[model samples]
Target: MQFKSKKVIYQVFTRLFGNTNTTNTPWGTLEENGVGKFSDFSDKALEEIKGLGVTHIWYTGVPHHALVTDYSKYGISADDPDVVKGRAGSPYAVKDYYNVNPDLANDPGKRLEEFQELIARTHRAGLKLLIDIVPNHVARNYEGASTPEGKRPFGADDDVTLVYKRDNDFYYIPDQAFQVPDIPEEFKPLGGDAHPLSDGYFDENPAKWTGNGSRLAKPNFNDWYETVKINYGVRPDGSYDFDTLPQGIDEEDHNVHYQFWQDKDVPGSWEKFRDIAWYWQEMGVDGFRFDMAEMVPVEFWSYLNSHIKAKNPDALLLAEVYNPSLYRDYIKKGKMDYLYDKVELYDSIKHIMQGHGWTDHIPVVQKGLMDIEHHMLHFLENHDEQRIASPDFAGDAEKGKPAMVVSATISTSPTMVYFGQEVGEPGAERAGFGSPTRTSIFDYIGVPQHQRWVNNKKFDGGQLSEKEMALRDFYQRLLNFTVKSEALMGAYEEIHFYNKEHTPGYDHRLLSYVRWSEREKLVVISNFDAERSYDCDLKIPGHIVQNWALEDGTYSVRDALYGEENVLEIKEGVGHIPVKLEPLQSYIYAVGD
Candidate 1:
């Protein structure tokens, strides 16, 4: 149960587990086509992932699923519509709870062995493994939903119920709980038909939003996903309505799944999920990177956090919650070890490289990192969104890309680099689906494929870009600093702004913060204004501000304050040392020895 340091996480996409191929293929039958078992993965691939300065690899999409051979499975195909869409099935569709897709391991037992070996190798190389687990729902037609061979129900045994009554059943129970209407929460619902026979790719429409991959295939309960809907309110009339309100925080709190197992302590469900986590852990995984943890009940996660820690305290738990407003609740309730640092990421990248105008979104990001001392999961581009290279690469690969990488890694949180990210992999065309296949992420997986197809000249088509490599080297330096220096590792004591009034000139557009440890202190200054520059000096504790050193490894005295070893000057006026910042340029200065 011991976990790896939370400083690094590598995003491992399921189907592309080892292959560099970006194709969206189902995990059910990869071996039938020749990929062999997960243990059979080429050593070369494992080493490739290890090359990045990552301490843990977040393996996305590793659970079991019923592979579909039908072309019309997901409701879109070459014939139906969305011709631009790829044929890969979403791995989010869970088919079994006790097993993994056969394709992942030649023999499930052998797969575990291989995974164990991988973990050992990772640990030897100083890395950890984290597998993905989905708790919200299961695949449509799971087990009995299809045939005798596949008939697995939602819960193991007595957890499922058949609601046939309307008046008495909660699905049809009339009360104040069922108040909201389907028309719209605020605005009217818009009507539209499917896109016309326009060769899907022609229009180049912006990507579609994504959802968790579980499927109900019917209107049973409030339908978060269109493909599968569960019936939360069951009436005597043999009908059920998911959209109806149940007794809880909101209409969506019906908890149809929980109701199925209500008689028992539903909160304890974490044991089942935790057991699965342990199963993966036993398989030699370093830990787990939870998916949409906020969507699950907080109390349930608390149990999980405690249980996982009991087994392995070092196990890193990264919660994928995007908004900052809810981070405190999740962190407090679930005891989730880490959450995504959407704030620092957006503030540093979009606002800094793009423009201070991007700061419009800074408030949200800032609040999420409110406890700026403890770290949160941070990244520039992950599997969930577009590549920073896409919008900000700004035509010139050299300057645009390198600056972005530097900005992302230097933030306080441990950095997460999604697959193809270091090499400037473009995000999926579809942004928010449970399974992000059909998007560009799936198209450029293999090393050979990426080199030939990736348009960026900076990347040789592998997971490394020239700028990315340089930035990666910088990360290795930072990692060495983070792992070796206890003071620089997690959270800062305080962050202050050195206003222009105190100095010759200062710009509010420049986002700067000071991170310090009793033994060491470093100031991070980022000029968010892509068009303008800022000349400023951070006001620090007099003693710590006495001297400075540049990246070249040379030391100098701050004569303006005091001479070398004379102790820093803080007796009177503001100690201002001029820092000429360029547009979008960022600096990390080590203050004290």
Candidate 2:
């Protein structure tokens, strides 16, 4: 039962998911783009997401961030355009950690109640809730107006005059005043639109360090200037102001880490983030996706995550760590349940999909992380990545089919499905801040392809074309089986190497693997070729057949992806199943005795 409950995270950008607006004006006001509300995620919407076999829904951008929108009526302060990334702000620049985003609420004044209702609705749909918890930084103006009684905002207790201190929440420039980054002549805050707040000046005496750790009074335009770095007791000289973990602690479990920190005194910032996480847990949030986890110290994670596990041992602590070398440190010492597998598996698959690399490199990547495979979460698309259908990417959504199958079933790790990924949403809009290949989290813009599936709040794919519907069905079938199949969480062996050496018609464009458990067995193969189709007598070695205890008999084999019936004939000892793979096609054959 341990591996049977495989996790699939369906990440929905809260402000964009239910927004049906078709007018995608660059740097358009929230009214023009029509931001999706917390209420937009109706019960039917949650059920539709749950229907995709998602165990958790990552409601991204839930926390209140520094947006250019005017919410003064709700007692929320307006953010200067010079500081914000886009009309709608970057989710990582959290303005207030204690409050939910007003843009995602039907009534800005009752935003908290609406989010709580969303948490209830999400749980009622038999799915857990996940939200972003950015501990490394906060908006330049961190106003905790909604912080409950007795809870102070960040920097409230900091000695702002000091450059660094054990109790200080932020690193300061001492006497220097903060100046806005020199605006490049080519770029404007609201796509060159005029706003009273876009005057290219921010008034701040004794400027704090930038979010990316830029210590200058005026951070560069390319830096995360909208946000300021949180001081986790890490000094200017790169020394820890807090107690370090015991030696060899990275090899121990979270419980051991938790016990070690029980008698120790942690930094003030550590306590602040722990309290924020506890506050969300009280509101029924089951987990957090820590933003830019690598930027923060691994020791802080060990402290906070261990405390989190103490309260809810099953809590999912997923982190956005991209460095391969830091992967084990973040997972083991940091006590994170999962880390992004972007650098290894994801990059390799994307290269193959873009017709650049051979599938032979996939096994090499997978083999390197066999010990910690379960902690490496797999995903093809996320908010930061370009859409599969974008011209800059593969220029075809169909290419993701085989890649998605291989990503999901390759190991005993969790899988993430970005919203609009299933329906082939090409992020072609000219959003304000960044380039267009990836969906913009900066400006207020509607997701055109995803809106088709939204279909005027119906939450049904009523407006989807046949091809889009077929693509979604492919995801539906594949993900539904993945979440229920114990074999996906079992032992894995790359059979493509075996097939390439032994079987004819098998080439480098094809990848084959086998996964099995006590109850279920799966033979998975995918074709990465964009123009070539493959027809190969897929073979499992004699040792694997003997391991499965297959006798001289014909076994029932069917494609779990398309329900294509086939037979696995065991002659002598080797098991053979004939497979036909079109360009970018994949098959997960369930072998039954």
Candidate 3:
């Protein structure tokens, strides 16, 4: 695999991205809160995103999911408010695999067509499209009303009488009638507003398992009660009913894995998901972001991902597998292109940003995952994580600057930034289903900071404050530089160790590293301290200097990020560069000839 330009994924919650309304009434209706439609992502909007240096747009919640709104007029059944999480449903609780959210279409009946148009628009803007693929579970009332011809909905032929069956799409607690969860006093399905299906009653006989694998007849409100787990041939006794991958087969590529499953007999769920992935690929989607990938079996991924890769060899397959032990297994065997670096890299960076961690630990992590660093996608904010400006996270959005600098330029892996992260969206809305820290994935809420940047659909920062504009400018500079920098796509060497020993005033709160290609060389440094600027002598090791074949003279080094120029004195194969960085400052210096 040759080195490619660094990929920057801009994850946009499709419904919320274009919503301009500020009416944030808790448990508000779609009309009251206002939902962004597929038409909202106009050509100008996509061009602006592309200008921000994004290579792919992960259009979250694009698939048809359960919602509280009544779409019965469009031949879609009304979802019971009792089982739904919020006015807008959880994107992971996909109700239809072959269709898109009707709420996102200007014409309800043309939702799929609208999404297809969005895909074409994204491609025209020179950006790839990524949508969610929740394989672990589906909506409680899973229905494929718009499934393609010759394809049957999941569990259409399953034997519901049996608690566990290889062909069954869902697990069941036989003879037990499903019961609605007990609601808390302060919370109501629709803010105490009366509705036809708000009576806390659902019609699921022989209660199926909850999305979180809860077998209780009435799942706790905190559980994933709005959805049900998909059965993947794993029995209740923890044994697989289907064939497992051969030993040591994880070393093989997707082509070999695709061939391995050629004559194999997989479970019904496996084939169903494989077909679903292929269907989307045929629809012009470039790739998929698999949600909660760890919950599903790795073998299923091997089958699905390999099949998708066989169809489109360049399809980006990103997965959300938190378990560090299973990271390599999923990448090598499951053929995943990237996995979330949440546990090791993101957590470490978050801790450092919170003033409780050491910057020294970052190099250790990078070195530890050196072999698979390219496969680990880094991000400071996503849908699930609290916003950088949120009180629950680093209260100051400026704290994300140095952290993002390290994340984006640390390695050859792809970097992701959530929508409005650049403009410092605090995500402090009360939005019905969840609390303040996270932007509600389950509610129809307005993102204030993002709306300011949206500026009534102008796609410009016309309404943003000076500070917000500066922050966005910082992000644009960093991301654009990252994508076009040859050094970032080349080799990495941690200079933090040498700096900690030889460079005076350099401490654990500061970090330095070097990235170089045959043509370009860069020395990156960051100051994580919230207070106190630092002026130190950043050192380049003698071995590296000799390797780079620098002559014994003073060379001018220019900051690639901020355009600050400095001189580097090289004598006897040791390069000493004078560096001055303010609090929470990052400098990416391009070493010149």
- Model 1: number of backbone collisions: 36
Q: Rank the candidates by lDDT, best first.
A: 3, 2, 1
| Model 1 spans > 4 angstroms off | 1-6, 17-51, 69-86, 102-113, 144-153, 156-264, 267-271, 343-352, 356-369, 372-375, 392-412, 428-468, 490-496, 529-573
lDDT (tens digit, per residue) of candidate 2 on 1-593: 56556799999999999999999888789888888989998999999999988999999999999998999988888899889998899999998999999999889999999999999999999999899999989999898877889878899988888999988899999989999998776568888788888898888789999999999999999999999999998989998878888889999988898899888888888888989999999889999999999999999999899988888998998999988999988998899999999999999999999999899999999999999999999999999999999998899999999899999999999999999999999999997888888999998899987999999999899999999999999999989999889898789999889999999999999999999998889999999998998888999999999999999779999898878999899989988998888888888999977
In model 1, the worst 10-residue window by lDDT is 168-177
- Taking every candidate in turn, the Cα RMSD to the unseen true structure, in Å, is 10.4, 1.1, 1.3
- Candidate 3's C-alpha runs over 4 A off are 1-3
| Backbone collisions counted per model | 36, 0, 0
- lDDT string for model 1 (57-98, tens) is 776656655342322432312221221112233455555555
- Score residue 133 of candidate 2 by CA lDDT: 95
Each model's lDDT: 0.45, 0.91, 0.92
Task: Please estimate how well model 1 matches the true structure, expressed as its whole-model Cα lDDT.
Answer: 0.45
